[model samples]
Target: MNKQLIFFFLFVLFIIYSFSVYFSGTTYDKGISHFTTEAKLGKKLFQEKNCISCHQIYGLGGYMGPELTNIISYRDNDESIARAFLKGGTAKMPNFQLNDEEIDALISYLKYIDKAGNYPPKAYEITPYGTVNEIVTDEK
Candidate 1:
């Protein structure tokens, strides 16, 4: 009887876990949903250049480079971001030597990412059980 009860409890927990995962929302927003041709190309370029090997997006990639989730909003603008590509990176990052078009596309993709939302949210409420609750507030 005890073994059967344990099995039932485990099964119930599994169902709850599955439901939560299914209902969880994705990080992407309308911007990502409506990707432009240039943004698509930029995404391809980003993958082809192996940017994920060093830089991260939404805090999911490598730690060699800084997180690029909101880089455009904080680090000047598109022109400067493009310049970084043209000028190459510091000791840690290598220059890909991307052309003007490629740089533009990359910037477009970055803009889309920036518009998506903040990642690793600035403020969040943590539960005792280890679940993090995002503090969604209107942007001033």
Candidate 2:
């Protein structure tokens, strides 16, 4: 393998690792916590910045990227998206420079939306097989 290709691959790996750490750091349940103030501010930024211009959530905005309603589950963190937004990608893509707080606020707003929207209750049980039951249901 060529040295140039090896260097390029390593560089890409570094970028990936950096993004993963940054984004994961920002994700947390913060259950029942209210980011209303931040969300409100973020909403204004969302509209003003025309994020919906290309992205959608719960059936609104342009049809470019995936819906952002549950975007946190999609990307590792805001840093990844922010980096993508600022660094630019393909020809059609554009860069938007926003500081850390702005990105955090946006993420907070998105998390608020996702929580309000509700998800299926989680259930867990021990299982052994499909054709045979490890434990039969109790009957009275």
Candidate 3:
């Protein structure tokens, strides 16, 4: 009888855990799909160039370079980003020698990503136990 009761309690706990995980919501921007031809090409270019090996989009890539989530916002427009790409990156970043069309596609993809959501999560709530939680806020 005791074993049966323990099993029942464990089963209930598992069910609750599963439900919580299912409803936790996703961090990705569902609206940001690479459906357009330019966006798709840009995504391909990004992968071909191995950008993820250094820069991060939505904070999921490598740590070698800075996170590129809100790069457009920081530059205030796409022209700055295009210029940076044209001029090649800093000492750490190599020149891609991408053509004007390729650059345009890449910029389009970046703009889409920028419109999707913010990154580095500005609003953080610090708990008494030193645990930091991300607080989503409206963009200004």
The best candidate by TM-score is 1
Candidate 2 pairs with clashing backbones: 23-77
lDDT of 2 by residue, 1-140 (tens): 99999999999999999999999978854443645888777777888888888887666778886577656544543447644653454565555667767766776777666654423223345655544333322110
Q: After superposition, how far is residue 86 of candidate 3 from its true place, in Å?
A: 4.2
Where model 2 places Cα greater than 4 Å from the true spot, the runs are 1-33, 75-92, 118-140
User: Cα lDDT of all candidates, in order?
Assistant: 0.76, 0.64, 0.76
lDDT of 2 at 94: 56
Kindly report which residue stretches of model 1 are placed more than 4 angstroms away from their true locations once superposed. Answer: 1-29, 76-82, 124-140
TM-score per model over all chains: 0.61, 0.50, 0.60
| Candidate 1 residue-wise lDDT, 2-118, digit = tens | 999999999999999988877775542556663789989988998998888888898889888888877787665545864685457667778777888888888888877877757
- Per-candidate count of clashing residue pairs (backbone under 3 Å): 0, 1, 0
- RMSD (CA, Å), each prediction: 8.3, 20.6, 7.0
Q: RMSD to the native, candidate 3?
A: 7.0
Cand. 1 TM to true fold:
0.61
Which residue pairs of candidate 3 clash?
none
Error of 3 at 28 (Å): 13
Question: Between 2 and 3, whose lDDT is larger?
Answer: 3
Q: Order the candidates by TM-score, highest first — what do you get? A: 1, 3, 2
- Give me the displacement of residue 109 in model 1, in angstroms: 0.8
